[model samples]
Target: MLSWVPLLTVALLCWIFSAGQPYGLPIAVWAEDSSSLARQLVRMLDATPGLSVRAQLLSRAEAQQALQRMDVYGVVHIPPHFARDVQRGGAASVTLLHNAQLSTASSLVQRDVRQVVGTLSAGVEMQAMAKRGTPAQALQVRLEPIRTQLVALFNVSTNYEQFLAATLLPALLHILAMTAGAWSVGRELRDGTLGQWLGAPAGEAQAPARPSAAQVLAALLGKLALPLVSLWLCGMAGLVYLSQLRGWAVAGSLAWIALGLLLLIAVSLAAGALLAAGTLSLRQAMSGAGLLSAPAFAFSGVGFPLLAMSGSARTWAEAMPYTHYARLQIEQWQMGAPPAQSLPVIAVLLLATLVLLALATAALLRAWARPQDWGKR
Candidate 1:
């Protein structure tokens, strides 16, 4: 297992950074009073790499309008007293409002906004200390960090590499495991092996018989577990390695990885069982598995902003369980959401998996009992 780690790591690395594109995070800024400090902040962001000032709104209403229309992914509004408060050695409120639909953009914009705000606030304090004839070191001591309240409704930093790398594990694992398991069901019935198992008598020394339903379900789940664990560990570790190399701070706990793994396993089993129940051919099952990637990647908002999506698109996104799971994974991993916050996300995913599993299991049992119906007359 350890020997395979390096090879797996390299594969993940290649997949993640292969895409070459600038971080095109769109942002809108509104300064209530048009203060010099606020204007400076906008200029700084425009000059900053990885960030783009898509538009500048003059009023709070304008900002809200842009957000509702999704003209921008995120908004940064500086209060009228922003400069005055800073100059007076008092704290000022700068509202950072974002469309709940664009969670990823929310985090990215907030992070960069804080960096810009911190630099500006520090400059203000340094000037005040200079007026007091304080040393440069004293100026540093007097500079207080500006607090930013971030509300991410959707992918929050748009860190393409981390997002792509982390999700690749579950996505690939599900495809491989589910496709194989689904194909196996059709193979057993087609090969007449299922009848052989049913006809075999229990030996006198044999222990109490295992429930056929339980055995089949367990076997399917067991087969998926190995790949599930491998993918989870490799993916998380790979992401951590990437973050370290890029000097990015991952905010979520390792516990979230455990939750993510369990969710992936459940999803894989459920999807596999569903495909098996349909008696899909091996090629068809594999094709179905491959089809999952397009929607999974899209609804997860890896490249696009969810806020920018229309209501119809949003409805479609909500239907995909992988979409929410991927979003939660990214939130916990890249955006620094704590375990407590991530628990609800895990709960929802578990509930969805359980529901799907129950329906799939019933369908499988019916399909198994009536294999002839699976074929066209």
Candidate 2:
């Protein structure tokens, strides 16, 4: 199941979000002004990427009806005497009446509409304030006196596919890695084979034949080694596909990303193994792994900003390995941030993996020494 699920998910998501950004979202304009300025606004709105001025309604009532019928995301009402009001420095407000239900589409419409109106308003304001000058001077006055240029970085285009899907694939893989690790360890406990797997026995052997510490460690490693390699390769494969075949650019060192992903897989596996060893019950361990990893993405600040989260919620997010990996992935994949910026996060994942491995080792050692704790369905 793990082998093919990631493959299918990657394909499905890439296909679904193939268009990097939303485009041609339908909207209507309510032109109560019936003036040249109003028509110019409509043309500009239609020209903006991801927006289409589909209708020119005569009244707010007609626009609202179109909205209700799901014919458009929202409407822009050019208020009566808009041109005269602007010419007279009235600061006329072009109202954006939009359906909030479809927030994404609505936001796009709102942005484009606001930009068009703002541009037009600036030209009117600049002309009203000063006499004609050289075209360059006029352009500078219009831009400087009335409005400021806004530049969005990293995700300048606001490509949802790049923003979400790139990190999503790794987050999903982390969940699977943890679950598989729990199943590997928990199954031994469930079948009463913890001692055998740890190179101990049904009961502790007399000191001479007993498993040495190195032997015990080797035994566990031998059991999980294949799964560890397989899962890590899957992660690398997904990344390669996205960067190479899918046309997503890798902005930073692929080495940094590869290292981070490897650590995350190890950390997840160790956490799951620890959970299984601590619980000594297959079902409980698996459930615990899911409980820990499943909801972590939400807290990782992917869909929401970390700065906006409440103190306790932010604290919780910082405690998860997935959060660090997600941050590291974005730093390297999208931001192409300096290598130094990601060093601390990578260290955290490495430290977490080590700690979890130690804890799991201790738990397994305890479980192995006490055979009676095994066979707990």
Candidate 3:
């Protein structure tokens, strides 16, 4: 029914973008002959757009080796007799061994090769007909498209698991931090627990002079350390797992990665504190947190390259504290840079966090200064 329109719309959109996207296609080729003809075909395919040739098997045995290893999408074979058969006007066939898992690119390669062969077959037929040779025998031309050379950049291996795992780590870290910080402060406000903190008897209080800003800051920092360390450990574990298990390459130093992680936590904590101060209750803070998540994700350059975004969107992304730290993380972790290079950026984030915490404390003070309605109580 039309009642499910929004759900259906989302589902359809997800399918459209996810289905048959060529960003992660893996294609492989194996040629037997290594003849001028075979070389020509290989060159053409290598030059062909969209497909990335991962590796070329040197022999039929190598092709078998690749197939057993499950290293490629498809294996192309140019029979040793291809050139002879074409010259003798007899039909020849090229064998393509393909993995069932990489169906999309395999199918595409199959169709593309067939189209090329069809064109060549037409020419062979025309020549035979012109020579009055009864247009050849059962088959015209048999030259099969074989393995092609492919050069790739950044993600040369074409491993989807590695790609996703690497990028998702930093994004997830920042997201969870944002959620935790926002929820923690918001929960206290929404549950009216803040009143308890604000209303504790002076003598009963735990050795403090009217709960100063420094005390609150120290308390929040102390409370945050456990979660912050946990998040940092989680990020490191993800990076290590991907690198060791999946062969994900990281371009940054471990120290730099740690710095980035710390910066991201700082950014989230600052944003959460600011939100807490602005909102009257936990419900409002939670709503604000929800509103911040999507923009933070989008602005972090996970969905699209920040530079490619429109003018205003690009500006917004640049302005976002999370965006800067995310970029620093990627550069430090995936790109493999030293920690020293990120010092200035980390310092900036720390300073910004301090500024936001100061602002939140100011707001908290203003709230505390408000005259109480003891009559109702």
Give the best candidate by TM-score.
2
lDDT of 1 at 243: 55
- Candidate 1 residue lDDT tens string, 161-266: 5556657655554455455445555454455444333333443222134336665555555655665566556555655655566544556765676576668656
The order by descending TM-score is 2, 3, 1
* Candidate 2 lDDT by residue in tens digits, 230-252: 77777788778778887778898
What's the CA RMSD of model 2 in angstroms?
Answer: 4.1
Instruction: Please write out the lDDT profile of model 3 over residues 38-67, one tens digit for every residue.
Output: 666666556555455678777878887877
TM-score of each: 0.53, 0.81, 0.58
- Stretches of candidate 3 above 4 Å error? 1-153, 202-209, 338-341, 371-377
- Judge candidate 2 at residue 13 and give its lDDT: 69
Model 1, CA-based lDDT = 0.63
Off by over 4 Å in 2: 31-40, 54-71, 80-91, 99-104, 122-143, 146-153, 191-196, 199-213, 246-248, 335-341, 369-377
Clashing pairs in 3: 29-147, 190-282, 251-334, 251-335, 251-336, 252-336, 252-337
